[model samples]
Target: MRLPGLILIVLATLVPVIWFAPLAGERDAVALFSQYLGASALILMGINQFLATRVAGIETIFGSLDRIYILHKWLGVVALVAMGLHDIIDAEMNGLRGGPLSGIAEDIGEVSLYGLLILILASVITFIPYHLWKWSHRLIGVFFLMGAFHYFFIEKPFSNFEPLGLYISAFCILGIVSYVWMSLLRPMTPRGHVYEVDLVRRVGGLTELVLLPKGRGMKHKPGQFAFLSINDGALGEEHPFTLSGAPAQDRSLRFSIKDLGDYTKRLHKTVEPGMEALVCGPYGHFSMPKGRDPQIWIGAGVGITPFLAFAESLRTADAGPVKLYYCVREQDDVPYAVELENIAEAVPNLELVIVNSAEGIRLTADRIAGDLDGDLSTAHVFFCGPVAMRKALKTDLVLKGMRASRFHFEEFEMRTGIGLRVLAAWLWDRGVYELEKRNSALRQPAE
Candidate 1:
């Protein structure tokens, strides 16, 4: 977890306690604690919305969107737990309540809780299609608004909780503001660079798109990704993809997208040369450092895209010994395999280790540990692959005395839109990834 995000979560959890501790002695103990729980959850949720904003400062502090998403996920779980505790503890208070407004408030709170649960669950389960999941995510703002209504109108032990009520109200307002900006305003804003589709190739089961900027191109480092939205019949939905090649003077960009879902499946057929697209950002920090020790690069299937960029960046440099472990089910499944081989042959310090699971070759941590000729402690390991692979390798390597900080990976699996459809697609892809990994593992050569 990023230090700033961790700090924010700690403060958000503790500040509410600090604010309400003085009033604890004046009110019923259980009632005051429940109110405090609810208040802290709301504050955390507001901070959650803020962190989701792709602000430069937050991204820098959080290190990358990958870490940001992790913090975002944990905060959501904490908020939900807090809200659940609040509901249970406050359930008996309704029997002693005396007004119509209080009953209405209780009803609103109940509804918000249920709605939030559904939305968060949809987000957690990636099997939900992206289109439906996208909509489900947006409904959170509606639930938050209702929660704010409940907070303001409800009968409370600390009804006169001074500016605390006002503070929560501000959070509610900001939550709505962030929802509007992300779902509406951000998409409407023109991209930093507009590109014409120079070429679209269907290779294996993936679509390779080549983009040529129409005006001044956005400068980006290798291994970073960009969001692309085609103006053709493809709904103009922006999708993040890693740059598959080094920075060039022509400012041409290439994205190798695997046909995992509906959007990508139709990409080759729907997108054509001369088509225009809005390109925003070269986001992410999945790159190697210049002064670091030998690098261990791992890429599985389409995850090889970033490694291609990294290899391109290292072509002219005399970096220390680097080994790339490229994994795929078959020779044909490896994207950019030929180009990668050519680059590896040209760079003396770079070595390519191709692992074809079809032939019972597996790229496990123990296998890598055995293959390395030098001390593993001084090597920086970078991975871009399925979440399961990353987790397994990271765990196994860490247990073998490798520092966790020496391992890094990028997570492109994100809740992009505020809809259930998007969620479903993400979930569906995640399920497929896990299944593929399992099938591949079953084919591995036994030790």
Candidate 2:
């Protein structure tokens, strides 16, 4: 099942408490509702902590690590909103005398809420340095600990032994355990395999690192990604990058990284051969499908990394009738273009099309269908590009008779900002377009 279904199931499990929990006479409806929201926020915060653990096999349940991270983001957002509302709504109940520790608990709760707000703000502001943002993010668990303490000591209508109380307490335990495991215990344990970098090549904005395992290497399929952490102090943080080469027997790995961020820019300049590295995955579900259906692969800019793995895999594997479109600004911007052309020449079932957008050769749905002789109805479309391009192409392809289910792409952003300004501008543009359309229709003669 998808993440939304799982989230619904979680909320559904809590809904019964509203009816089953014993109440003290007739309470203020708004106050009681706010209390429930507070409870939900705490429960969701617990699940949010669990999701951050990155435990083995958990990605399978959410389809991919990308989706898991997306769910993690949304859960935090909802929990934050609920918590804010609970705080603003004033959930104090009459005749419910405070617990012995209620004063201390209330103070802790206030601190946690404010601390969480500041940390979350740091996370949402994309301009911050990655290391600083990460450090702030780690401190969030401390606030969660404070929140749990507040929940434990705060006075409420239900007794500690009551059903609702017990259920929430179980979640508190889950959150605490998850936090300990992720932030403390997990780091102490060895993870992934150690590899020594054999070569480092820089071309334009791209940096390619070739690594040979010092011990047993990770087993991975084509088009999967891994978390890479170099032992150097400057590059110690683990960052996810796609495996740009096909899996080999000697357990070697290759990563094609673009200098897009602060850490990557530092890596491009500082990383050298013989550096110790840790590789901790083979995650993601963006692999070649098993069926023999015709395929259309679209890659733009550095998004072309995965398709490199896919193309290399075709040497021994039989994937029938694949059309690969490599989109870049110009010929100079295209990485591994000659290699792809050579592969296409050697493999009869594969065809390579280079679309240079700078020269006005955009990869549109019409262009795709025209090249395929309007046989796109049966072709499965795989895309990796800017989010706007993906949305536009997907909409156009579906309108041109391609199945919506056949379109596949990963959510590429590892960290996303709220982009409120962009959203507001888009909404204003949409409103103006609607108004124009209405005016045009009204001016036309009756049919």
Candidate 3:
């Protein structure tokens, strides 16, 4: 089965356990429950990683999939909160605070502390835009391992009755073990392409890099991304980066990055050729053609990276005709400027329009339509950029009466579980409100 399908299934099966946890017991039950929540969240993260590598052309949502991305991230947040509550109650209930250094309570307390630390680290790292936070964020994988250990040995929630309790507990622990083993220890090279940094250069205000695989072709479709890591750093953390080059006919891959944070800043001053990098992925659904008709690509700033890959692929007859209306703050902000035009020249169907806003050039979808000659409604718009710009474009598309199936975007959400739960809860609340409104209207005397 595809990784996305498998991951979603695992998560869906586990969701019921957490949902029913409150009914199993009292306050301690809630605390006990939190550990499982964390376990589930970590597992989902692993699932997402697996999906990125194993699934092809699979998206989290059918329409503009930002909703799924948000859900995944928020679910991680919920898991964090649950772990916090788990620690507090477990500490107080077991008198763990008073235990000796080597006692069970101390170990549990230490584990809880570590879990909290992981949450803090992941949350903090996510705040930085793209490449800066990208590399270091891979450390969360280590924390996920720590959390799994904490889940099983921390509280020993097996102290319950009936078959389902122990059965589910064992299932959860097994899942955690499998996820951790696959994530940190296992390597995905498999006799094909292993990643290596080709060149790291200073372009405009950013440090951009070119990546190529070692000994094998780094095969991927256009509009996909790969995770990156520098092996030589004090903190060898991996981050996801969108492919910025045309899809390789020979399996070579390329990436462009900017120094948006501490990780990239170091890359600017330090990263070099011949050094190895851990690259995992080619994930995301920001692609142009995906069982759809003509596509429209919307971009801003470095978000244009993936679209450049799409356009490049179109240039080489890699896929199909894809029209691009890329937005940038200034003419200079567009990466691979000459290459983008060169490809457009080679492929007549691939139209590239640059809105130079540095001196105040304004643009919208209406302006974008002038560049292409086709049924605009048939085009599925793909976007990757700052959150403000992304949201604005989505709103614009909505106002244009574009169908949901005709829009797509990518936001590399850092977390993965709580958002879905919250969205579900919110939806539940709205349903309740509508029912209440109808009830009140029915109660009123008819005029």
Candidate 4:
């Protein structure tokens, strides 16, 4: 979402190559390139560790925590690939002799590479439970430490005091510090505002938590989310949930959590009134748009949580003429449906539309266009839903004269796969499409 952060990552990866090139002397070209890949891998892995810390204000550089995590996931994959290449390409420098500990360091490097591969695979595989995956992910820091040890002790072309060596050494220190802070120090320290559970209401698979501030509560806007961690033993892990109510003077926060994962299911069953919890945010930029321009808000299933906060905030805030679409598979599955309807009634500029797919009703782009007086070019559409639904709707709406820039949604999947199958299928489809287009053009006769 932001350019500078990504630009910095690219610069970090390439600058070392330039710095090391002048000192290459008569080294083997392929072997030296392999060494550069190793340096790039270590640098990228260091950045990954820093991102994992979730430092405050870092999200501003990357847009949101969701996007930050996406970058984090891909960077790890790329780093692993780079490491694999470095290993396979044979980086033994000519006339470079090992020090006393070089043999042990090289062995550690091999172990780190294989350990990282297994851990990263565990992360990519979706069948593993979240807690187990998280634990395995934490083990990455161990391998990183091992790799850093190898970098320090293994015989290389440059001395530790050289520019190239110093640059990489800095990242090694950064990686180690980040890992320690995140895995060791940060957890020992108390973070975020403490709150007591004011209410726990369950409706079907949805669990609503209203948290009352124990001391100073977090300040947040509508459509923001917080990481909530209940103090109960099994439920102590922090999980992100969108705030489902408008910010009030009481400083109470509301979270509408769907029982989608193990942690959430446990929270639904075990959480109760008066339970102590920690709330570590008010994160995200999924707020309502300003100005009097026409706006369309679409929320599918539990994706409606943020829109609930937006709707509640509309009671006082001055804004646009808005059409809110609440899409659900069944009528009974809609959380806060009545509340949303009431808000729509109270807010003169707001309108509510319910699309129940189970009753053979669909929220199609043509239907939306028709409702907006057969023109979609002037309207801004905000959506929160499943990935397939978002992709399809965005494609259709853009084709129906809506500007691509006006279609907005948070790309907020916490655990996404490496997408090997998706990429292969997309490439295959594109090739077939191109071939068909070429054949059609050839048969068109002097077009």
- What are the per-residue Cα lDDT tens digits for candidate 2 across 188-293? 8858889999999975468999999999888899888999999999998899998988999998999999998889999998999999999998888888887788
Query: Mind sharing the TM-score for model 3?
Result: 0.66
lDDT of each: 0.79, 0.85, 0.59, 0.89
lDDT of 1 by residue, 1-447 (tens): 568768866775676566677866666678788888888778778777777667667777766776677677767777888899998885344333235687798899999988887787677776789878767777887787788778777876444346665666677677767777776787677546899999888766678888998998878888899878898766387777888878888888988889878777667668889999888787888878877488899999888889888899887765888999988997455667788899988998889988999898888778777776535787889999887789999999887767898998898676532345676789999999999999999999999
The predictions' CA RMSDs to the true structure, in order, are 7.6, 4.9, 9.6, 5.5
The clash number for model 3 is 14
Task: Give each model a TM-score.
Answer: 0.86, 0.91, 0.66, 0.93
* Model 3 C-alpha lDDT per residue in residues 309-389, reported as the tens digit of each score: 777666446444566666666544456667788888888767777766786876665555554452466667787766666
lDDT of 4 by residue, 299-333 (tens): 99898888998899998988879999999997455
Window of ten residues with lowest summed lDDT in model 2 = 16-25
Model 2 lDDT at residue 69: 78
Better of 1 and 3 by lDDT: 1
TM-score sort, best first: 4, 2, 1, 3
User: What are the runs in model 3 whose C-alpha is more than 4 Å off?
Assistant: 1-72, 81-162, 178-184, 187-192, 195-202, 206-208, 234-236, 290-292, 318-321, 331-334, 369-375, 412-447
Give the clashing residue pairs of candidate 4, or none: none
C-alpha lDDT (0 to 100) for residue 156 of candidate 1:
63
Summing lDDT over every window of 10 consecutive residues in candidate 1, give the lowest-scoring window: 90-99
